[model samples]
Target chain A: MTQEAYRNRVKAAAPKSPLGKNIVMAFLFGGGICTVGQAFLNWYLSMGLPQKSASSYTSMTMVFLGALLTALHVYDRLAKHGGAGTLVPITGFANAVASPAMEFRAEGVVLGMSAKMFIIAGPVIVCGTLASIFCGLCYFVVR
Target chain B: MQTLFIKTPVTVEAHAAVVGKKEGEGPLRDCFDLVAEDIFFGENTFEKAESKFVSQAINLTLKKAGLKPDAIDLLFGGDLLNQCIGTSYGIRSFEIPFLGLYGACSTMAESLALASVTLSCGQISRAIAVTSSHYYSAERQYRFPIEYGGQRPPTAQWTVSGSGAVLLKNGGRGVRVTSVTIGKMLDFGITDANNMGPAMAPAFVDTLKTHLKDTHRKVSDYDLILSGDLGSFGMEMARELAKDEGIFLGENYADCGCLMFDLKRQDVHAGGSGCGCSATVFCGAILPELESGKYRRVLLISTGALMSPTAIQQGESICGIAHAVCFEGE
Candidate 1:
């Protein structure tokens, strides 16, 4: 009858163990995710990048660079794996910005296309913008 | 045919909760002004668990709406069931001309929009859009039972174990369905239905933008832009995200999902989900606020994810869709 009804029946018949499988699949993807994260660690090891410099570099570049790849629609493939894999920080923020930019494209320019696109990403940019400014002041003070 | 200069008049009436065959009705009973014995099981039908609760709720709502069998133009509803069997049974019992709608939490908004347009077009006169939910029965049947001790993430919300029904009329100077902002189910290709805030945010942004465009009203115009079930974390995320667009929904943008249970007492770290979340809030919270002149115009945005575990297993991305209904109180 209704799609909901059909889904309910299918869900009722769904194997319970599948949740166990999902749990395992979720973790397996996470493990793969960690190995990639380690590669960033390895970048420092291989390049002789400094400790504090490498850590900041890795995290910042990871988020900012991931934002770049995400806009190009490259990292979306890995996100399909679900959970911790997609949620591991850097890529998540990238997703935050790229999604709205893509959506607002259809509304043309006035408000929908220009203004609405930043709803989610807007906060990130605001915080990020302010944070950088604050950090600049601190850097000047310390220097 | 009746013509009003405002938004649609949709009232959630006749709310009743089953107190677990327990000692008392708890805060919910007091809030809805429902009597205890009003709950009764439908005989020879689906077991007394899910089916009975829904039927009892429907009858209560019907009574509150002052509706008789022949009076209800069309019965539009669905629940967590196969073929919306619970809704089917409710429809069968009342025998009102029926149309089943499934938008998960957004079902109430979806049905109201349809019912309102029908009334506005003279396709139907008096109509009812109803949705019922039961946490205990639904958890047992679909997801894990609470007793199962499943480790829920911060993203998850408690499914509201309640029922909500609204009666819409041809003439209510209070409100009319003026303009609707339709939303697309943005998956962002996410599959984790358990943590739905992010999945739902895209749809929320889309719908809110569309509503402003169609109605030509700024966010500040409406007193509230309430969502169905985005929990505490979801609310924060929505708030933080909305600010990025130079839009701030403010505290006026609360969600029904976050208010279903006393999360602290129930160990509901987040809030609630299901159709009942939005339904009860409309009847209990928003309606009262409106009636008291506390808020003039309100927008209820109910969001739902259009995905199943099977779809997830089949590697389908979880998509979220939201529909908005604007209601103004007299």
Candidate 2:
């Protein structure tokens, strides 16, 4: 049942639905999310950012924004609908990181969520950033 | 189809693996290659466990059955994917003609039934029916992992990811698939992928009734009857549903799901749900007993809940598939 897994559930809950509205709410929330992403992308572009820079800015803005919302449990509330919509984008990763942290939120910032929250995502970020940087450096060296 | 008797099953093999933090509990699952430490060590373990399982199963089954490489005519098998990449991909390494098949958990039985009929019809002298699955592959592709600890409702039946093979050939002093009863999976519009037991129960009942009717055998005719991975809940539901159909599968009836996990220990909540779940038990435990002539007759009902995440999200009822293979000793 980890946030990382989107499907197979071994210790799954008793079969039942959370009901009608939860599904519809997914679309409503998903549209709002994309609209926010668009707004951020526009704002970054308006500030005279280059295309790649604006893209990175938008991606980061959405991820961070998703992280904040996920921390607040708002994205989880919206996950029932967008199917993978809300969860597939950067927000899903944030939710993956934040939900676990939020669960241990009461345990405090250091030992609880902050430590274990990024257990799944922390290395992903580190390795990804490091890999990208490494590739860039390799290109410069070859050039 | 007419009857063609085969002695020993040509092949039998099994493997299981656990990824991330989940404990590998089942007797067979416990023996799997643990990916937790490897993933921890930055190993692209990926299908290592599953691939190992396929190789081990083929090797074991071939060894136990005393079959040479060239003896196997055609291999029939499949998995959870629409294209059945799992079985086909792993089987690519083995140089054998294969016809991929899928009936979900019932795949083993379906393949067996087809092979039985094929032998009966004298199309080929021998054939191997292999089916497999893995928790990690299934989880990565199908549902959430334990790391996320996502909340799942009861309706979902865990997708079983294990493989099992049954070899059928000419005469021997072993158990032969005497007859087969095939059931069409029916979806009653229940869309909850989590609680697949209930969605699949009706299919079990319908097929059981069909088998008994076709064979003209009573419930007591067979010494033992095992359903593929219907799990504990489906076992209960099948019993109840059978009562309505004037059949009672009580004393000797068992399920792969119930046997796969100690619900109390892992709090598995349900029972084991995977292709290998039922296939392993059928080939490993049940087939051995059948070979020993412990029972003059046995009925193996492999069950399957054919539901995917897309189906559930689309709000579609689940379909259940079951294939009954009658094992009779000479």
Candidate 3:
């Protein structure tokens, strides 16, 4: 059979991911994570911290929780069920940075763990930086 | 003819399978010779643990055959690791003449076929074929880190963390290697690395068709037709493709991936995969069934995807190959 014919067959035969269920789970879980962050921010603000400092502390706390869950190997399990829920949160970024560090730790400290620490998050950082610089240039030219 | 009919009787003397904690909880849990509670198998790293799994399987097979490692004239093995390091390190302490293979998931069938051919040539007296794959090692190499909170699609298959070893002798009273049909690489334009079932189904169908044609045998000639690691989706594709060619794959047809786990209970999305999937399933389950006269004649076609992470990223379609080995009961 031609490759095109086979591709069509594969498209038909392949089982699709449950988009409806996944969206529901992602919304609920993602919202729940954000709610927790908001709760942390509220707690900090109640302690007389400024709004910006409260927000920064909340993000740090969420990242710390993400890294902790990843170390405990609970984040991956949650991500499996949560889909984008665990990933869109700061916890997901923490997992993206921490997982490879733990996985490649056996290779050595420098080349293995340290080097591979950003294997996944590296692309995000690079792209984000480049985009930010481009936006900054656009803003300066517009002004 | 692509198929080689072995004139000299080459029989499977002994075989053993060792699986990890997750696989031990599978449906075929009791079939395995050893189910390690520790995923590391007492090793420091997952890679080393995979090598240890291969070693344990070889040791168990040797003990079952009541022969020392020196008695084996040649050893054929491989795995999914880079440079086939899993086999190299796993079998290093044996001090046996080794031939490392890299047929991807089809390494078991490739090694077995080569070992059978060598033994049938009357030069080698005894040979062993072994292969292994670890979930963590394969994941880190092919997909992502273990703790990465990324969701896998439904088509994704769980790599079996296990190893299987089989001892073959020149002539013995057991299941004998009857013939083999080596396959050609076929690419069907499948680029999704996560969906290996369809990517490899064409190769399985091609090899099965070639084997049947060259051997002048019909599908009904064999009691069972088994494909390695095609999972449910790939098996359906194979059956459909075979039907298009006017070949019927009936109730006797099964895939090692589908049989490796309980699909509903096990949470293995598509099923079990990797080199160890077919190897462990054959050694732990099918061989025993064959020995007990449950199956008179069986055909095993192990299919493999030949695409690397680099090739996939470069927008190349996955190429698949399969090797068919026919075994008959005495």
Q: Model 2 over residues B1-330: C-alpha lDDT tens digits?
A: 222233334322222222223334454454444323432223233344555555556666677657765777887777665477767776777788888887877888888887777666666677777777766567655665333424444444454445566767754445667777878776554455666776677778888888787667799988988888777767766787688778988788888777766666754666777777777667656666766778778888888888777877677667888888888765
| Overall local distance difference test of candidate 3 | 0.93
Sorted by TM-score, highest first, which candidate order results?
A: 3, 2, 1
Compute each candidate's TM-score over C-alphas: 0.63, 0.66, 0.99
In candidate 1, stretches whose alpha carbon ends up further than 4 angstroms from where it belongs are: A1-143, B1-29, B33-48, B145-147
Model 1 is docked with a DockQ of 0.01
lDDT digits (tens) for residues A59-98 of candidate 2: 8888897778765656655564455557556777877786
Superposed Cα deviation of residue A56, candidate 2 (Å): 19
Measured against the true two-chain complex, the DockQ scores of the candidates, in the order shown, are 0.01, 0.08, 0.93
Best by TM-score: 3
Report the lDDT of model 1 for residue B54.
Answer: 55
Q: Model 3 - which docking category?
A: high
* Cα lDDT for residue B79, candidate 1: 70
RMSD of each: 19.1, 13.6, 0.9
lDDT (10s digit) by residue, model 1, range A21-109: 55675677657655666788789767998787887777776667556756666555555444555545665665655555554544456
The candidate maximizing lDDT is: 3
The lDDT, on a scale of 0 to 1, for candidate 1 is 0.63
